[model samples]
Target chain A: MKILKQLKMTCKDTSPLISESMDGHISFGKRLRLKIHLTICKACQCYKNQLEIIKNLAKKIGSEDFSSKKNQTLRPEVKEKIKQSLNNI
Target chain B: MNDRQLDSSMWVDRYGDIMYRYTLLRVKNVDFAEEIVQNTFLAAIQAQANYAGRSAEKSWLFGILKHKIMDHFRSQKRFQSFNQSDSDDSSVDDYDDSGHWKIFPKDWGLDPEKAAENTELAHRLEECMSGLSEKFRQIFIMKEMDGIDSTQICNEFDIKPTNLWVILHRARNQLKLCLEAHWFQNKTSE
Candidate 1:
């Protein structure tokens, strides 16, 4: 019973660790504790899965080129002038 | 133009559009993004001699562009205040004193592969991101999108690691709630 108590973590204690774990910053002991807690706690597991989805989605959104939607670009004249400056340097 | 100069010109030709896209997403301002990209090229030109040929030219240019973006954010007094004011509203309160969620997370029904192919979802996500407070949006983008290290982000923002984690936690929670309402739940109801 004492051994089980040592591994127990409430969702409040473990939720922030979910974010920290994603960033690869959590300590190994806390990670193990979180993992053990996650195995038993379905709610935190759902939270962990959802955060992973959000992170992956954010990364995709970040890498995407929205130029086609907005049609924003450096004008040719600006590009030409920058190149000219580069040449003069 | 000499070979080195020609190389520099080609760098702009190759990286200008990519950098413009990246900066535009972060700043969400076309003119500012353009100015930053232009300045990145100028800075590259001024520091041309320092190019060690260690990293890819694209990466080196990106390093300069990232600094330029950080400078723009640092100069914005509004962003600093927004950062402070928004802390009270963080998702930290969602958890109870016992450290369990007052309201447990709802299943998101996320399909990452399908979502990746769905341009509409991508656009929706961009909208959601833009909806975030400026500082949260910037830190979230820098960490998740740009793949900047946490320690570097801490130093850049003059924030402690714990503060960074709290901000990131709130950012993720906010984004999840936003996307769940806009994308996931909307899809189900439709």
Candidate 2:
């Protein structure tokens, strides 16, 4: 019973670390514990998978995409405003 | 034609739109973004003599824009207030006392290829990002979109590395939840 309780606590504690681990390094013990918990916990497994997808998608949809020349352009008037500001400087 | 005057006039045509878009994503306000970009160029003009061509011209302008962005948030006190209110609400609700998810993660129910290819998904993401609180939005974009390093983010925000991780963790959680509800789940239903 105590082992089962500890396992549950391990699963809970390691979930956010799963997300954080993607950005940087995690300790070997924690990584081992996370792996153990993931084997037993389907929900956390799903969470880790989804977090990976989110992270990948975010990397793909970078600031360049939002600022892509074909996607969004400054209004001509705004451009004019900037040009005027520049000339006045 | 002095270097400063020539550079100032040419920058409007060359770097203006790109800087505007970059600032717009961070600031999430068109007018404010425009103003910041304008100031960035003006500051560049004033400091053009100091720009020794060590970096690319575009990078130099971006550096100035970044400082202007920080100034905008700091002067408005947006980050301080929003961090207090939003962090309080999110940090408590997402995880239970035992650090387990109160709500289990939901399957997105879409093929990864299809989801990534969809232009509409990208549009929805920008909308969802805009919905984030100012500080979270700024940090998430700086880290994920702009690809800025964590250490740089910490120095810029005057936060410790641990605080940076906590903010990033919360930001990712909020973004995941937001995209699931508005994009993935909604699209699956439709």
Residue pairs whose backbone atoms clash in candidate 1:
A11-B99, A12-B99, A12-B100
Clashing pairs for predicted structure model 2, backbone only:
none
Q: Please, what are the lDDT tens digits per residue for candidate 1 over residues B1-190?
A: 3322326747777878778878888888878887888888989888888987777677778889989988887777344753564545456688878777888787766564454566676667777888887788889988998788999888777878878888898898888788778877877788
lDDT of 2 at B123: 64
Candidate 2 ranges beyond 4 A from true positions: A1-11, A68-72, B1-8, B52-56, B77-103, B109-118, B155-161
Per-residue accuracy of model 2 over B38-131 as CA lDDT, tens digit each? 7888898889888877777777788888889878876765336434444343555657777677888776755554555656666667777777
The iRMS of model 2 comes to 3.6
Q: Pairing residues by index, what is the TM-score of model 1?
A: 0.79
On a 0 to 100 scale, what is the lDDT of residue A87 in model 2?
71
Q: Which candidate is the best by TM-score?
A: 1
DockQ of 1: 0.56
lDDT (0-100) at residue A16 of candidate 2? 66
